[model samples]
Target chain A: MLETLNQTTFLHTVVAIGSFTIFTIGLVGVLSKKNLFKIFLSLSIVESSLFLFFIGSHFEVGKAAPIVADGIKLFDGHMVDPVPQAMILTTIVIGVAVLALSLTFVVNYYRLSGNIDIDKMDELGEVQ
Target chain B: MFNFEITALGNMFFGLTVLVFVSLFFVPNKHRSVTLYSLLFASLACIFYASDLITLFIGWEIMGWSSYFLIAKTADKQTLQKYIVFNIGGAFTLLGAIILIYGACGSFVYSELDFSAVPSGQVTAITILLLLTLFVKSGIMPFHYWVVDSYSQSNDLFSAVLSAIISKTGVFAFILIFFQIITVQYLQTPILEVVAWLGVLTSIIATFKAINEDEAKRLLAYSSIAQVGYIVTILSIMGSLSLEAALYHTVIHTFVKLLLFINVAAIIYVSKQHRFSTLGGLLYKYPLNFILLVVGIISLAGMPPLGGFSSKFLIYTALLEEHKGLLLAAVLFSSASAFLYCYKLVYGIYLGQPTNPKTEAYPRIPLRFYVPQILGAVILITLGTIPGVIVPMFNGILGSVGFEPVLYRGVFVLGSDFASFNGGVVIGAFGLIFVLILLFFVRLKNRSVKPKDRLDISYCGEVPRADVNLHYGYGMGRELSRIGLIKMILSRSSHALWQRVSTLFGDLSGITQKLYTLSAQNMGLVIFAFFTILLYMGVK
Candidate 1:
């Protein structure tokens, strides 16, 4: 029991560290970056961390895939929480949709003003 | 849980299936009736089969795409793309929130999901996600950036749909989630109070922005945000009274925005003029719509004896119940200021003298053009006249959320076992007084007060070109702009925050995008990083 408890804690510690690191990297990129394209890309990274954390927290010991093979079970805690995985799947699809849409925005921005820099947007507040 | 009935499934599939096929039909330019018809069918489907979240999402995404294509007609590709991107971003937030809930409970039906089961942290995350999505589409405060740009760029009638039906979906979604799925008490109130404050702040600032905007469509867009801010404020209260208020405001706002956008669209269509400085004296040109728009503006302004006031009345009561003296005062002040811009939208566009009579305006508006707008406007006025007519409907809508049913006796009355405004009495008294004034005015008038052209006033010592360039939209929202502290730094756009951030992003992406331009390298890195992180976690 103690060993299992220690292992669970260790797994959580890894998850906490990894997702936070990924999040930090994205944050730093978003904060420090000067390119519109890179900012959007960094946002994707941040989104990935959120997905990772969600999926990671739901992970438990001794769980097999929820998908029913001949002897496999469904929705048992022995399996990693399917909920977070399913949510991540949906979020991933949505993230792709938003990314494609935003990238198109970048393309249009480039076409209109021939400038891809955010600092170049002069028509909005205080820019001109 | 509501079972995914074949009928419901079929309705959603119709919109989904037609999206690709209809895209082709809309590809050939000038095929408007077909485009409008397809959208109407899809929108109707969305409205009817609102039980399942996933089914609802399909309708929402397809609606977003359909509207984007329609807006492409009036705007250049870039504006259309921005419009689509911003809307899609909001829609994605919603999808994330929905998926979060479904994941939590293993159900997509709105009816069966229980909030108590949602882990506290997940609930907060889900709420924030839902809030962000709705806030963007609702065009509240910082998210108002896309509102003016996209609405102004869309084809005239399409702008009407953009303002009216689309934004209301945000409110509907809020009602579903916040009022229904998530218990507001379990969530944070200070956050909602802040949202309320933001709503009020946006109203004040955007009202000023609207007044100063020279572009006709942009002015209306800002005005739409300001009105939406009021609706947002009411929604934050999360009570039976507030829910009624929010829904009432949502309905009235839909009609009012459609009224204003349709009139503007008709004006743009007829005269090929968009800016107020370039056009004038339209009260006679589009008489029916001008009156209709006036009714909407008055309703929007929360003036009494109109559909606007009924909803606005509820918002005020909700605020008072909270007993936030300052916030209530602010709400009252912002709405009072709303009247000024309401005046500006009407007088500047319709009542003022035309710069030159010879300047050609668009020919008479088509009847089909007026049909939808008139239908919306008429419902708004008729609702105000008989406030109780829709009280039961609101009761039915709110009933799904398990909120206490607000008292309705042909007029909504709030204040449980305490103070309340009897709307019928107040409205009836006002109506009586109005009739008395009309009779007196009729008795006093006749031969002496012959109504003539809207522009009987002097246009001269005349410089027609100077008149055309005159500023009509300046400094309307100035009073409320003083509260600049409300501007959020984290939003996609606010006070040049996004602009500077995007610029920095642009510079960095310029370097990295090239480095990652090859999919092979980028994919390898992504997969390797993904596996490395997963392995590290799994092994630990």
Candidate 2:
């Protein structure tokens, strides 16, 4: 039973369900948030779910990380596709940068307007 | 990483860019203005020489922002906002069209486009998108709300550049994209017909608006729109002769606007006034400037013995050749009506009695102002005397753009298969008649009696006071607005449609903002519901 659980299809299904669950949680937080900080955090959470989906879908039951090391001497099918993993790393860096910048903006905005709740923020002076 | 190629069409516009820039340099501007002008010139060159759509787009963006900053130098916040918003919208539409073409052809290079292989529907979509971009840039009808404000509000000399050279970039893009890349064979007839009608209607409306205007620069701005409208109309015909006509008009208009705007700028510089109500009796004070303005207006009105008439003649013959009788008639109507605003322009500033006592004390115009005016006048006169001087250049442009060469017998004659005229003969006849009239007037000068006092004329058996109102310039075109046709045209505003569209976008953003204003937990719940819906669909 344990060996059967190692099947590629089963693993893919598990990864899909797990990422979907995280994505839903993050999405809900984002859609309901009034605080600027919390909304951004929720957006990052949603982004992480996308990262998991991309990397996990490319995984095989027996494949190792793309790195060549002690047991793996040559590049072959034994290593999972490296492109998606590399792309995810880049995405993670960009995600961190964006989050930091947004948080700084939120801080500045709070200092100026004395409000962090998006509902109370009306810098553009739009009516109702 | 970028490709640049010089086609004949590109060369023609690039030559115009150089000409206008050189003329602008002599206008005595600030260092910052000069820098911006150079930047604009370079960007225009980039656009004209671009061999690929991406390069063209980059140049287009630079041109837009440079002009924005240039206009921002003298314009108010609202006008700047309008200019940026509309120009950015136009740029985005152009980008969308370029992307669509790239998607279909797998390349952005002009020579690589394979419209023949693409579906007709996609081609039409791309053409419409590109046309939308050109329409906005060229200030065609509904998209023209930003033009008058920007032209009126910008620095005087720069306004000349905007009207003279910057506007033609749109015409350049239209010729390049529609004629070269898309090719006329693939264009649907109905679409061209629609474009033709749009051009004519814009001219008619803009002519009336020009007549109704009180400000000098604003009137000229509207006149610019009307003049470009004829070019657009002729271009829609897409015949060999029509293209030549369009090109000829483009050259004539560039010189005319440059001369007129600078002439107006000189007046404003000396008098510190812009409204016709404040400016009058300036002809005697600045006789040379007055003469320059007359030349500009006569060319603008397409009167005989000027370069404008030659282009107008070509346009009429082109339309007639195509058997577009109704279009030709409408064009003629607008041309005839243009005379009213042209008269108002001259009469309001130069021919009428002084409206204010301060008119006599205004400073003399600087010598530098005459440089560009003199250059423009000489070019206009030469083109008028021998219109065929530019025909060879236009023929080369046509050849590079893959159109058949227009017919011409020599350097003095211009015509197609249907009709022809000798520019030299027209100018000679006009000159002889003018000289004869002058000689006759000079001969009769000694016999005629002069009035003892200017205000001595009897007004209902009462002498009018020195301060009594006598100037008719301000009210010259006032009755035009009362006409039924003009009244209806004046009642409608293009701004209303654009405002409605903006409000719709605002409503959409408002809805999104509401979603963004909710509590974090509620947002999380909505996201969960969205995810569950997606999962449900995937499972099914």
Candidate 3:
């Protein structure tokens, strides 16, 4: 059963379903949570799901890692494309930085206003 | 990365810019910036000399922003907002048209785009967008919502720039785009007719509104709009003669407005008063300035022995050449009524008895003020005497834009084959009559009895108090409001219409605002919902 599930088409289907499910859970958490920290955390979860989708969809059964050391002489069809993985790696770094910056802003906001609930933060005042 | 060309049209515009800017240098202002003004002048030259849409647009934006900063030095928040919003909206519309042109022709250069290859529908759309931009820039009606506020609220000296130089940019662009770029072969006639009607209608309404204005600058502002309206109307005719007519009017109006606005600025500088009611009895106090203003108004009203009449005559004859009888009638009507506001401008500021007790102590006007006024007066008189002198320049412009030059018979005579006038005869006759009247006035001065007091006038057989309001300026144009036709004109306000439009947009934005809640969860939900919809569409 493990060998059967290791097929390339089957693995792609699994990856799609798994990542989409994770994305939905994050979306639900984001839409249902009132705390700013939880919302941002859910956002990070969504971002991770996107990274997994990109990396996993590009994977194949027999493709080697795109390292050109002992046997691999050039970046050819024998190895999987490294562009999406590289892009995802850069995106992950930026995501972490953004998340940290945003969390810092939230912490400052909470310290100043004594509120983390987005609904209760009425700094913009009444809509008129 | 920008291309530039030097055509006769550009030459004329740059010359006007230099003249107006030099004159404005002598105008005293506390908030004036040489850098900002120099930037504006350079940008204007860039626009006039630009051979491509990109360069034109870049220069246009710089001009708008620099002028905005200049006006912001004195204008209130509301006026500044109006000025920026309308002007930016105009710029964006022009950009849209330019983008459309690029999409069709794959180039920004004027000479590279061929209108024959574009579809008629696309051409019409581009024409309309460009016209809207020009209309807003020129302060033509319906799009002229920002004009009065900006012109009046700007600092005194810059008002002349706003009226004289900046407004002409629109007319210049109209000529550039319609006459040169599009080349009229692909033009739709009905649109031109509508433009002509719009022009005449704007003039008629603005004339009435000018008459109704109480503030001096506001009156001149409305008058400026009306004069530009005539130029637009005449231009819509699209004949060599009409183009010449428009150019003539444009030159005359530049000096006319510069003189009038500067004259009013001098008065305000001295008295700290600009309202018609408080300003009076200045004719004797500042006789030279008063005379200059009279010359300015004479040209403004399109009266004989002035450059204004030569242009107006050309406009009427051009209209007759095309047999646009009804339009000509409306234009004539507007021109005739313009005299009322012109008189009010003069009578309110100078002719009547002094309303303020402090008028006796107002200081002598700075000698610098006379520099521009004398230059303007001399130019106006010279143009009036030799109206055909500017014909060669206009003909060069017409030739450059692919039109036959209108007939010119020496510097004294001005007109086309349809009709012509001897400028020399007109000016000489007026001069002779004027000198005779002056001599008669001097002879009569010996026998004329001096009044004991200003209050010596018999007022319904009763002695009026010193504080009695006797100035005619306050009630000069109030009678026009009672007339049924003019009342109809004055009753309709573009301000109210624009307010309704803004409120409608406000209501629309309010609906959009419902989607934007401050709560983070709701925003997330919106994002999620948007993505889900996109996913569903992609799957489908």
Residues B347-372 of candidate 1 have per-residue lDDT tens digits of 76776556545544357876655665
The best-first sequence of candidates by DockQ reads 3, 2, 1
Worst 10 residues of 3 chain B by lDDT: B451-460
Indicate which candidate wins on TM-score: 3
Error of 2 at B389 (Å): 0.9
Off by over 4 Å in 3: A1-128, B447-456, B503-517, B531-540
The parts of candidate 2 lying over 4 Å away from their true place are A1-128, B441-470, B498-511, B519-540
Ranking by lDDT: 3, 2, 1
> Candidate 2 at B361: error in angstroms?
1.6
TM-score of each: 0.67, 0.79, 0.85
Q: Compared with the true structure, what per-residue lDDT tens digits does model 2 show for residues B369-388?
A: 88889888998888888888
Chain B TM, cand. 1: 0.80
Each candidate: what lDDT? 0.70, 0.87, 0.91
Most DockQ-accurate candidate: 3
Question: How do the residues A25-122 of candidate 1 rate in per-residue lDDT, one tens digit apiece?
Answer: 98667655657788788889989998888777777666676676777655665676677778789999999999999999889989988986655655
| Tens-digit lDDT string for candidate 2 (A20-123) | 99987887677767788888988999899999988888988788778888877777987899989889999999999999899999999888989999777656
Cα error, candidate 3, residue B38 (Å)? 0.6
